[model samples]
Every structure is written in structure tokens, then in C-alpha cells.
Target: MTRRPSLAGRLSRALAACVALALIVMVVASTLVMRSWMLANMDSELHRLSQRAGERLDVEDAPDDEVDTDDDSNEESDDDSDDDSDDDGARTTLQSSGRAPRPGGPLVPGGPKGHGFGGAGIAEGTLQYVSEDGEAAGAVVSNFSVTYLNAPALAILAAVPADGGMHTVRLKGMGTFRVTARVVEGKTVLVGIPMDSIDDVVLMLVGVEIGLSLVVAIAAGFAGRAWVRRELRPLGVVRAAAADIASRDLADESGNLTRVGEETTAGPVEVADVAGALNSMIDAVEDGMERRARSEAKVRQFVADASHELRTPLASVQGYAQLARRDIGEASRTQALERISSEGARMASLVEEMLTLARLDGNRALTCDRVDVIPVILDALSDAHVVAPDHAWELGEAVDAPVLGDESALRQILTNLLANARVHTPAGTRVVVSVLRSRDEAVAASAAPRGPAKGGGSATGAQASSMITIRVADDGPGIPADIRDRVFDRFVRGDSSRTRDGRGSSGLGMSIVESLARAMGGSVRLVDSEKGTVIDVTLPAA
Candidate 1:
């Protein structure tokens, strides 16, 4: 795959392109304006020269001056005499300053005489004129000398329409000129000015503009790149943080958290906003990973504890089976068989509890129905009395609190709570089972934030005063204080001993109770009691 260019590079290119385009437009407009101004100045000068030439032409009215034009030498002599003895004594004379006019290219200057009249703009340039008829013309070099090249030059000038509008034309030997025609009396006189000066100035202006534009554009490109990179520095820090997270060994469950610091989150508002979101995302990921690590640890402990639990019953069943095989006597064999059967039943119960907890953790949806928890509480109390008659079991405040839950799960929850009380307490412990409405407040008819479906979380409307609370309390030695906080954790019991009351009580009983309660959108908690264990199970009212 082709790698894309960086943002800095693209932005720099765009900035340079914009700068260059603007400069080009400005340069083009200025160049055109300059050329137009130069042309206008040339036109004005050409018109002034042509008008002066026409005024001079009307001085030569003698029939001899017109006839002598056929001879170049005689024409020059007549022109000198006419210029020296002008009829008005104020003759409008024309002259060349430096270069002599080309051979057959004389009698062209139309300005009045002298170095004082010709400045830097017109000095050393040729001035040409055409007669009224198409056949005659004259030129004068800047030295006040007259010459003739009237054959082709006169024909080129004769084409001028005397419209006073300037037009450009090139002569055979002379350079390009801006020429115009002015009619005086009945004759047409043409004036021509060279185009070299204007062209040189315009060319230089265009050349300088192109060079300057390139220099400025290149500078802008470099500066823009640096600026863009500077502004994006915070983003680079964020990327490094992400990369550090991505490269970590998350599968190993090490739970080393990662995050970008305040420096990375500090920048322009736009970048800062994105960085803030990035930090939040990092926090979420770290939390999830930490939870996963804790879950894995719990899974390992569960497996080990399960192995220990099943091993005892298996060993007992094996030992009893071996004893029955020996046949010490018929009565002894019969006792071994009964013992094996009891152990097998206990193993089956443990396995079933594990399966139920697993299903609840998997978030399997159960049949929800309105369950009258009062009967369930009484049933649990009766069963507890029959099993542990030495303990006084009674129902306390059995209210008409019907709850929305799976009935079987609710029975199992109550059964587990009562069983815990019976198994852990001494022979004379007083146990009370209660089903009462929540006293906090009425539940709002709206959804609320919840946790995993299995356990350890409350559902929406959990705080409603109308909720059902099933609390099983026993007046006996309370739970060990150090383990009270985690009493509901799997395999936790009042005592660490594997067997209780000569029976293996699967520690999963409380865990299952919590899981089932939460799966039904309820929650269970171990309440702090002064001298005994008290557990409260709260469920949403139907």
C-alpha cells in the first residue's frame, strides 16, 4: 500500500500555492498597467511631433521647393533655405541629436529645433514624415540634417488614415515605431516613434516579478511547514501514548495502566478537546484490562478450590467402595454403600450449583413473573426449622411485597440465605426471615444505570420505597470481620474449614444467591449486624 503524505507537507504546499497565485495576479495587473502607461506617453509624444511637422510643412509654398524633391541634393539645399527664411521668422525646425539618419532615410524629424527640445525620451531616435500624396516622404536624423528614403517608407506612412489614433508599424531598415497621421491645410504628415524603450522596461518588470514570486513562494512553503509541525506537536505525544498502549502485552493480564499526561492534553482548544477524549478512552481501556486481570485471578482460585472440594468426596467414595469390596461383614458393607451414596449426592449438588452460577454469569435470560415472596420466605423458614430444630426459626414482618423475578431463582435465593444461617450458626441460634417493602423512596418509572447481569449490581428503580427487601438474620456469632466485606465471594464461608456440620457445603451458595438476584434485576448485600449475620436481598416491586 502507498503511504500517504503527512498533513504538514500538504498544508505547506497549499499555503505556498495560495501565496504564489496571489502574487501572480498582482504581478500581472501591475505589468499591464505599466505597459499601458508607457504606450499612452509614447502616443502623446508622437502626436505632438506630428502636429509640429504639419505646421512646418505649410511654410514651403514655393513651386520650386516641391519640384526639387526629385533630386536628393537639391531637396536638402531647398529645405535649408526654407527653414532659415521661414515666412513667420518663427520656424518650427526639427533635428537629430546623435545618430545620422539611414541613407534614403532623411527629412523625418517633426519637432522644433535644438538639444533643449529633445530630452532623454526622444534623443538619438529617428523622426519620419510622409507628404500629402502617397509618393513623397522625408526623414531627419537628430543632428538637424534632412534625408530621403521616401520610396517604401512613404508607402508605409501613406496607409495611415489620419484618424489621430496611434498605430504601430515597422519599417524595412528602421525599428518598430508608434506612428500617427495629422492633416494640415490639405496635406497629410506622418510621425513615427521607436518602441525599444517601452519594450525594455516592460520586459525587465516581468522578469523581476517572476523571480521575486518564486523566492517568496519558496520561503512561504518552508515557514508554513515549520508552523504546522509546531502546532501539531501535542498530537504526536498522544500518538506515542496510544502506540505504547498498543504495543503492550495485554493478553498477559499484567494490568499496567497507561495514559497521556497534562502536557499532551494541553494545546489549542481543538487539539485539547480531542486529547481529552483520548485520555478518557485510555482510562476506559485500562479499567477494562484491570477487571479482566482480576477476573482471571478469580477463575484460577475457583478452579483450585473446586478441585479441593471434589477431591474430598471422591476420596471418601473410593475408600468406602474399597471397604465394601472387602466385605468385613454384611452390616459393614451396607454402611459403606450408604456412605458412598451420600458423598455422591453431595458431589452432584456441588456440580449443579456451579452450573447454575455459570449460567447466571453468562447472562441467560430467565422467565420473569410476579412472585409472592411472602410464601417463599415462610417455606424457607419451615425447611430451616425441620433441618435445625435446635435453632428457633421465625418469619418476621412477612409483608405483601410481590416482586418481578423468576420464581424458582427467588426460592433458591431464600433457600441459600436460610441454609447459610442454619449451617453456620450454633444449635440454639434464633433466625428471622423477613419480606418487607423498601423504605427509602418510591421507584421512578425510568431506566437507571446498571452493572453486569450476573451479580454485585443494582438495577433501575433499586432505591424505590416500594421495593421488596428479603433479609435473613441470625442471632449467633456474626461473620468474621476481616471477611465480612467479601462474604458473598465464591467459596467464602463463616469458617475456612472445607466441611461444615459433617457435610461439604459448596461455598458457591452465597455467590449463587447474589448472581441469581442480580440476573433478575435485583441485588443482595450483607448488612452489618451487632451480634449476628444479616443479609438483605432487594428486588424491584411488580
Candidate 2:
């Protein structure tokens, strides 16, 4: 099968075709106009020649002179008679110039007095005289010595009406002529000129037109192709770039997907727009691939961390079960049972936290309701006091702090932050939870270091809207500087060794807190503090 032509090729061909078509139309129209003009000029010349012949015949028919009898009477006087004779001679010479010679008579090469019948210095042409009854009277032929007045030629000439207008006729011995017949002095005079020169001019003109038209068509095709190519150069560059992109693996992290350069993008608005759009599409695809890679990496780490956390609890439970099955005292059996129960609880909690993270990652919608953050913070403090009494837990200056969120998720956020403080720090660490309503602008302008919220949420319009900020700060060895920025990343733990008081912490507490906060159209960030880590949660107010 023949491959279809490219867009550029098609466009070039179309341009060339249009140019050729227009040139052909102009050439044809101009040729026809020129032909008509030449024919009109030839007809006009024939009519003028015929009219001149009629005028000469009319002059010849007039009386030669008044027959100057005064010349004879004055002959004795030399000066007077000489003057009379000169006058008579001048009149006689003028009459003789108009008269036609008799048929079969000795013909003057030029007419009498050196003037031809048509005009002085004119080319010799066909002339014939006919009687009023349509009989040939006489004829003159010069220049071309073709026999005139054969039977067919006489019939054609006799049939011509004695009108002043010219007509076309074909003579048997000759070719074609434009002739005119008119009555002068009671006789028919026929004047004619050959049409060979007019036919030759028209034929020559046609040949030149054909040759020139071909040259112009060829030139137009080549020139049109070049012009179209130059105009579509930018599109060609875009096409090449697209083909190059197609050949490479876009998902390959190491591959550089180059964009259309400025040189190629510059030109007409339409072409530049296409180039710009192509670049934008490439950038978007590259960005999407990077995000996908990061997502995959996070998934892998999450699976590994979850498995490791489960392994510890499973090992402890297994050991306890084996001890319970051994031949031992009732007291020893009871202790092993208690240890197994504790390990089982720990594993269950770890699994629950993992499930919650998965749900949040899936963007599960939560209960959207107005909840007062102060009450949630107080409840979390009470829980923290119960979980770790050795830690000094307190509630800072509180406010209404009404916000839009799921009550359970909001409570979990507070619980996670407070628990993180309790687990990471030693006993007697004062963990304070503060709830307050603040403007977004004030928080943004503050010099305190901030962390980014992790969910797919935007807070661009929140500057003008109200927000409630909750702070869970503690006097503990703050998160290590090395992992501070990545505190909210999944599987990242403050204690890189993943141990706190000989117990394994799941390390997903802070990550869940940030994800939940972002899901509720809010943000969570770690505030810089000299004494301990300060985690701030900002939520849109109800």
C-alpha cells in the first residue's frame, strides 16, 4: 500500500496547484484579449484601404479640367501664356493621377506621377473593376502575381454587395482576402488585402503563450513548494521533537525529554502556540511520571515497614504460646498467657493504624461537620494522662476553635500528636495542647519553620478565610535535624533505630496526622522550637 503524504507535503502540493491554476487562467484570458485586439486592428486597416480606393475612383471620374481656352488665346504673350500653360498642366497632372489604366494596357510600375493607386510607397495589392451588371471590367495585380478572376474567384467577387463595409472571400487561385466593393461613378470597385499576415501573427502569439505558460507553471510549482516549506518549518521541528519523544521511554527516570527550543517555536502565532502546547504536554507527562515513581517507592517502604512491625509481635506471641504448651506451673502458664495477650494487642493496634493510613491515602471522604477543637484537645490530653501518667500533660490557653472536619479524624489527629510526644520523650516531659483561631497570613509571615501538608489539597483561598490552629508542643529532645524535613513521610521515625522504651513504635502517627489534616482542607506543620518539637495543625473554620 502507498503511504499517505505528510501534512507538509500535502500543503505544499495544494499551494503549488493553486498558483498554477491562477497563472493558467490569467495566461488564457490575456491571450484571448490580445488575439481579439490584433484581429480588430487588421479589420480596421482593411476598411481604411477600401475607403481610400473609393475616394481615388471618385476623383478620376470628375472632368479632367475646364479645357482652359484662355491658354490658346494668350499664346502670343510669353509671360502671360506661360503662366496659363503651367496652370493647365498642374490641373491635368492631378486628374491623371486618379485615373486607372485600361485593361491589358502597359501598366505603370507605380501609378502615374509616381503615386501608387492606394498610396505612395504602399505595397502592391489586388484591385478589380466591375460593371454595374456584375461583369469584370479590369484588374490590377502586383507584389504577388496570382491569377485573379478565375470562374470561382469571379463568382465570389461578383457576389459581394456594393456596400462600404469589408467582407471575407476565398479566391480559387489564391488563399483568403478581406475585400470591400462599392459603386463609384456608376461602376463597382473592389479593394482587397490578404489575411495571411494576420493569421501568422495569431499563430505566433499562440505558440509564445503556450511556451511562456509552461515555464510559469513550472516556476510557480517550485517556488510555491519552497515558500510553503519555509512557512511550515516550525511545524516540522515540532513533529521531529514528537518523534524523538516517542522513541524514548518517558517513564525512565534517567531519560531527559527535551522540549521544543525557542528557535523552533518562534514565528507565526499559530505555529508558536502548537510548539508551546507540545512543550507543556511533555512537562506534564514528565511530572506525572515522577509522581508515579515516588508513589511506588512509598508503597514499597510502607509494605516493608508494616511487615517488620508485625514480625516482632508475631515472634513474641509465638514464644508465649510455646511456653504455655510446655509442662510448667500454673503461675508460669498465666504469665505467658498475659504476654501473648499484650503482644496480640500491640499487633492489632499496628494493623489498625496501617488500615487508617491506607484509607486516608485512598482519599476516603470523612464526616464533614463543625467540631470544636478545644473539646477534642481536652479529651486527647485526658487519654494521654491515662496512657502515660509519668508525663506531665496540660492544656494551654483554649478557645472555641470551631472547624470543619470529621470528629473522629480530628480527635485522632490530636491523639497521634500527643502520643508521639509521650512515646518519643522521657517521663516528666510537659506536653501542652493549645487550640486557637488564627489568620493564615499571620502564620505564613511568621519566621517559624513550617512543614508541608501531604494530601492533594490546596489552601490558596484560605488566606481570606478563617482557620483554627492547634499546637501540640513538648519539652522533649525534638526530632533529629537529619530527619526533621521528612518527619511526615511514611515509615520515617524520629528514632531511626525504631525503638522507644524497648517498645516498637509504628512511626505512622505523624504521617496520619498530616494526611488527615490535609484531607479536611487544612495543613499540619512542625514549628521550630528551641526546647522541643512543636507540631501545628491549621484547619478551615466552620
Top candidate by lDDT: 1
Q: Give the residue spans of candidate 1 off by over 4 A.
A: 1-14, 40-54, 57-161, 166-176, 179-192, 229-261, 268-285, 385-394, 398-401, 427-430, 441-467, 500-504
On a 0 to 1 TM-score scale, where does candidate 2 land against the true structure?
0.74
Question: lDDT per residue, candidate 1, 1-542, as tens digits?
Answer: 99999999999999999999999998999999999999999898887877666655421221222211322332233455655432212211122112222222222356444221121134456555645432244453545444333345655766777887889987667667788877777776666777878888989998999999999999999999999999988888888877877788877733554666787677878778878988888778778878888888988998898898899999999999999999499999999999899999999999999889889878889788999888877787788788788999988878886999899999899888888888888899999888877664443233322212224233455466657778888898988877776777888877877676565578889898878877887777766556787777777788
Candidate 2 on 69-96: residue-level lDDT in tens? 1122322445655655423321222222
Give the alpha-carbon lDDT of every model: 0.71, 0.69
> Can you tell me which runs of candidate 2 are displaced by over 4 Å?
6-12, 43-47, 57-196, 223-254, 258-263, 266-282, 389-401, 440-461, 496-504
Clash total of candidate 2 = 0
